[model samples]
Target: MKVGIIGIGHMGQAIIDGLLNTMKSEELILSNHRINDAMTTYQEEHQIEVVTDNQSVINANPDFVIFTTPAPVTLAVMQEFKTLSAQTVILSAAAGISLAEINAILPEQPVALLMPNTPVAVNHGTLGVALNEYITDSEPIESFLQQLGDVFITSEREFGIFGTVTGCGPAFVDVFMAALGDAAVKNGLNRELAYQAAASMVKGSASLMQETNIAPDVLKDQVTTPGGSTIRGVVALEQHAFRAAVIDAVEASNG
Candidate 1:
């Protein structure tokens, strides 16, 4: 039940953080392409095996190997593996790379493409996944992803949209949260407390929406009284075309 990682960047570290909750450090092995002080400190703190080359991690024969490399070089790095076990399930977290491209390199391999947002570091990630034909059992893969956060399995065609909305979503939310925090600060609240309050409210609002399964507009209506401040704020948002701006933001990312 070994898990091999071919990059030790932020996403890779987040994956390791989640995997550690379910597996021992000894079961995880990583390849550090550009090791530095941070990598050295992380390795020391986690006590996980670190290798210099990609093949070393491959030679470890992990049941699951994830590639978190840059999209452009992901395939080339994958090509380093000449042969792998039929049971090995390869996953690419690099955006824009697809299963078909990966299959071109290792035609017989089972592969998947996933886009996990930065929230994964906090174990509240939104992940978009698509599997190829060779992956017969997804329990292992889904189970693996669940350790980090919620998983959405979709077709490759829709994966890009899912990636754009969720992958690019965190930064959008951060901007909104920061604005809220700035408002609070302008109103005299402490900066740290302002951000915490804004984040908590956002988290609670999202959870309430998910748990109640209510449409966002319906939820807004539920909170907006006929002449209340909530309605005033909602009206202001609509007047300013916030929704249209968000839609455009997602569409603009099609590149």
Candidate 2:
């Protein structure tokens, strides 16, 4: 498959890297608003073909065109390519842009709205997708997305909430891990050891949650013995309203 990507920014580059590493595409065409020295270096390092104009990208006639530009710019680009081949599946990774809004720019085109996070660069991304009514389900697209990472199909309304969780969840987890590492360092462990220990513990705990069908509360109970060290840690977290704070953070992101 030939894939064309518009707006070669961080997220755009991430998707390009993921696709180049995982999929067998005949060619990958990329276009950006303004080329910089850094972007030129990236293109040379990655051996990707960089186009100078928006029309050049459309003229490439790729099977799929991914729009990684910001929401406002995406509409303008879509308007410019309003006459793209009907078979082309247009996918947008811009956050806060709805499938309806995308379809409004190209009323007859098949469009899919996708929310993918930075984890995609590591092939562990969690993506949520929603397609416009004009586009029927296609197995190839789902299979292609699965190659990047775990993917879920959601309604437009649920897309924003899921983005708050999986799209923004990694940074949230990183913040807690950093705090845990700091505490471990204060307790005499070296900085590197402290960070590794905290990170590995979190990874193992997440794996346990996935492997075991137990609820998180049940898992917590299993770890927290009566009047034990685990219970003491839990008590401290509760006193600090850790769970409430995390929930509020997610709510703020969704808003």
Candidate 3:
């Protein structure tokens, strides 16, 4: 299937990385403001078609066109794209640009507002998705999304909260993991091993909760024994207002 990608920034490249896993290089049509040496080499090495104009990508008649550009850029390009109709699905990763805003620009076309994070490069991201009313057949697009990450299907109204948590949560987890590594270093563990250990533990713990269908509190209880070291650490975290701080962080991000 032919896929058109507008913008070749970090997020755009990440999304392309995920798409490349499921699609051949030739299947993608990329358009950017200016082509540099890096992009020249990228397209040559990957054998992907690269265009300097948005209209050129549009002319390819792709099944879907994903916009990873800034909101203003996406809108500017959409305004200039007179021929984009309902045949191509519009999936945009421009944050805070609502579906209504997009539909206002192109009233009769199908559009989906997508909030994605950096991990999508590795196909392990969590994406916030909201499809417009024009999208009647969701299965194809949703299945297409599964190739990238966990798809959180919700109303566009809920995207703000979902974007804050999933989009910003990765950075929060990285901070927590770094703190854990520092503590481990003080206990005589090597820095590299400490980071790996912390990451592995976090991954395993998350998988346990998911696979067992158990609540976080119940899972924590299973790991904590009476007067155990785990409980001591947990209690220390609680005393430091870790939970409250997390809630505050989410609130701050959403705001």
What is residue 198's positional error in candidate 2, in angstroms?
2.3
- Which residue pairs come into collision in candidate 1? none
Q: Per-residue lDDT tens digits of candidate 2, residues 64-127?
A: 8889998877888778888788888888988878787878878878888888888788777788
Q: Tens-digit lDDT track for model 1 on 1-255? A: 888888888888888887787779888878878788888899899887678887777778998888898888888888887687777889899888888889999887989998888777768889888999988778889998887889989899999999999988988999999999998999999999999999999999999999999998899889999899998988898999999999999999867
Name the top TM-score candidate.
Answer: 1
Q: List the residue pairs that clash in candidate 2.
A: none
lDDT of each structure?
A: 0.87, 0.84, 0.87
For model 3, what is the alpha-carbon lDDT of residue 10? 84
Give the backbone clash total of model 3. Answer: 0
TM-score of 3: 0.94
- lDDT (0-100) at residue 242 of candidate 1? 94
Candidate 1 vs candidate 3: the TM-score winner is 1
Q: Could you tally the backbone clashes for each prediction? A: 0, 0, 0
User: How would the candidate models be sorted by TM-score, starting from the highest?
Assistant: 1, 3, 2
